[model samples]
Target: MRRNWAARLRHVTIDGLRAVVLENERLRVTVVPGKGGDVVEFLHKPTDTDFVWLSPQGLRDPRDHLQGAADDVAQFIDHYEGGWQEIFPSGGAPSEYRGARLAQHGEVSGLPWEYDVVVDSEQEVAVRLRVRTRRLPYRLEKTFRLRSGTAALEIEGRATNDADLPLHAMWGQHIVYGAPFLRPGARIRLPEGVQVIPHETAINPPARRVRAGGPWRWPLVPADGGGQSDLSVVQEPGSPSDIVYLTGFDEGWYEILTDVGMRVEWDATLLPYLWMWQELGASTGYPWWGRAYTVGLEPFSSMPTDGLAAAVANGTALVLEPHETKVLRLRAEVLA
Candidate 1:
């Protein structure tokens, strides 16, 4: 008899919440099925370092989850224990479309998604998670896979408009990086010819050093004191929050160089824009209280974080025809 040493899948509980974990020789991943199907942990075996950031709020048990609050943003932030989330139908602030109102960060991020183990083999293990929006007539399905002897995870997603009318929406991936893995000297590399502009709706003006609404080249940005801050390098967290939109990618790829490097490669045609969110202990509101420090390198199907309506008005929203489906693929790998 021979022993098999490939990837394996198992069910586990974290902080009293049901979760699924996948492990191999090189990596270990944990996904919470009930909590928006978020990937709560991504650990590199060699270094024993987890790349994913865990929110200070910690994991909230599904039993304790509150629903249907008057303030959607407050409700969303209350349960946001940082990790990777899939934003669909809409993004950013609350917006009205058709006759329905979409919540902040959309409906899926805080909703429970149905998950099933699709493959349980020695060579690879995969899981599929699906969810349907309450306000939008769309079904979202995502498949996550991890192969044996590799330090990478692949994600495939499909969004289908299940209604008779066309739908205008914003789709994005909210990936935030945090401490230990995110520190000074770490560098972020993106495709050349990229352009960026300061977010117009930034709440705190004093927290960020970059001038708002200014278009400039990638990586190198003009600082407050007329100096230049290299956007590629990770700096100490203490500054205020800043948001920016990135476009004009020569290629659709970005990498964060640290002790455990991470590279995200995607289809440029489907998600052509990138949203950079820097929260460096600047938020002094209810959720953050100026205690959170993280960076979000999000790839979006549209521009601006105002709302779906603004995206539609700017002609950046993706319009899906009746019964149409769009697919996207991306890979997150540990760089050698």
Candidate 2:
């Protein structure tokens, strides 16, 4: 008996933008090089499940789309067709660095990247993507690989500060999950001794259950109406939009299980903090209009979503001395 080609790499244009597809026997992963090198689609083929959440507005090419307003934050959110964005240099709100302003989640997520199909074999396939930030003196490179017979996608990345002066930046992986894969009964699993800290304020006040407090122990947090809300269990649709931080991880790994499951593991030292963003139909205004339901499991080198300036102020930002480079690795595996 002979085996067919188990791993392959292909390219296609998605919504007027170039995208690269890498797949094995179990998973099909799509990378959009023209839009921030985002992992727009991660499909578990056997189950026909896509774990990535796509914004209702869908992917829009910034080059072709006309802006309604001249806001920096809108520039990112208006085009935020949620998938998996590699946030760099700034992770949250717009902030100033050396008198230059960094856009919300800026310097990378909205910029186009250059990619090359570095490996194309029957047993494995890989692609390398590189990008240089427009407003910052930084260069980032990463390669994504998928191997035959494996359901895992491996990513190796390097971030370099190309300037002569020291640079501080907030780097993160903004991976989100939505409907079809995420639902009321879905469960989340994290490492032991993990602590959860709710954002001081709720993004959707009316729907939020967890009160703003804690370094609370794992899943159960003090609910607003005086009970404990379980963090491990996914809430029903129309629940609150909230933000929380998970810290004190002995290791960096998480599992989101529905009928199918996804397990993501990364270097804890490289990105020690995990931000859990729940926007399960609670945001009734602006971008979402209560139409989106998604959960973001983000790994970061910083805390809070207050941008690089805040990360630096709080001592959570990744600092690179002139010409220094930091390399990191992560893997996302699909489980049946």
Q: Report lDDT (CA) for all predictions.
A: 0.79, 0.84
Query: Considering only N, C-alpha and C atoms within 3 Å, which residue pairs clash in candidate 1?
Result: 207-240
Q: Using alpha carbons, what is the TM-score of model 1?
A: 0.89
lDDT of 1 by residue, 75-102 (tens): 5677788889899888888888888888
On TM-score, the candidate that comes out on top is 2
Where is model 2 more than 4 Å wrong at Cα? Answer: 1-4, 65-69, 201-228
Worst 10 residues of 2 by lDDT: 204-213
Candidate 2 lDDT tens digits, 120-199: 88888999999999888999998999999999999998999999999898889999998789999788888766666656
TM-score of each: 0.89, 0.91
